[model samples]
Target: MIDKVAWLHLHQGQVLSTRSRGKDRYYLPGGKREPGETDAQTLVREIEEELTVALDPASLAYAGTFEAPAHGHPAGVRVRMTCYWAPRYTGTVQPAAEIAEVAWLTYRHRPQVSAVDQSIFDWLHDQHLLAE
Candidate 1:
């Protein structure tokens, strides 16, 4: 299955994350795409809905895509995560809607994230963007 996600970097060397409502682990601040939505559309909409920030369409960069076993899904099911990196942004971030808590995460605390998010953390670390 396809899952569209976004990775927002803060000026403090931390990445934005959300504790999904009722979930134990934290995740990147994004969600699945709705019908008739393009990847960019989904990313922009999801981030706005979850973070209450406006994403500049031109600033969104395609980082990379990752795949892993879907969380809370039947065994053998996988999720293909299309992740993007937005190095610049506008507006303050806040937890909205289904998001219970919002925080910035550093590489030292990467293990606290979900499996999919761990993959993202590794990628960012490899790119030398994550703080050691």
Candidate 2:
């Protein structure tokens, strides 16, 4: 299983998502942890690399975890995604590095995300954080 992390930034009932270069599906921001890095460190670095923003470690809060078959992987390959919400951050979020596009998505956009991200959308909708 591949372990990954994601950032959840919600605004006006929509969630921030990103599509990487050459990728067809949009995903929550953030990425895999580097060796010897903590989740907070991973999140801060990944968000900066992908979003051109600085994630406030103090604002990090555990959101939820979701797992599903890894997209574009062989059978039996799975990804475990641990998500966090950072309400306090600095700079304007813009696509950077490999991020091809940045979007604010509602629950109605579920089909455009990965399976693990779809689960996140479901949970967010159930929590009333995502507009129907």
How high is the CA lDDT of each candidate model? 0.80, 0.95
lDDT of 1 by residue, 23-63 (tens): 88888888888889887888889888888888887888887
Taking the tens digit of each residue's C-alpha lDDT, what string does model 2 give over 1-132? Answer: 999999999999999999999999999999999999999999999999999999889999999999998887899999899999999999999999999999999999999999899999999999999997
Leading candidate by lDDT: 2
| Model 2 residue 27 distance off true place after TM-score fit, in angstroms | 0.6
lDDT of candidate 1? 0.80
**Which candidate number would show the highest TM-score if scored against the true structure?**
2
> What does the lDDT read for residue 34 in candidate 1?
89
- Model 1, C-alpha of 4: deviation from truth (Å): 2.3
lDDT of 1 at 48: 84
In TM-score terms, candidate 1 sits at 0.90
Q: Estimate each model's TM-score.
A: 0.90, 0.98
Q: After superposition, how far is residue 75 of candidate 2 from its true place, in Å?
A: 1.6
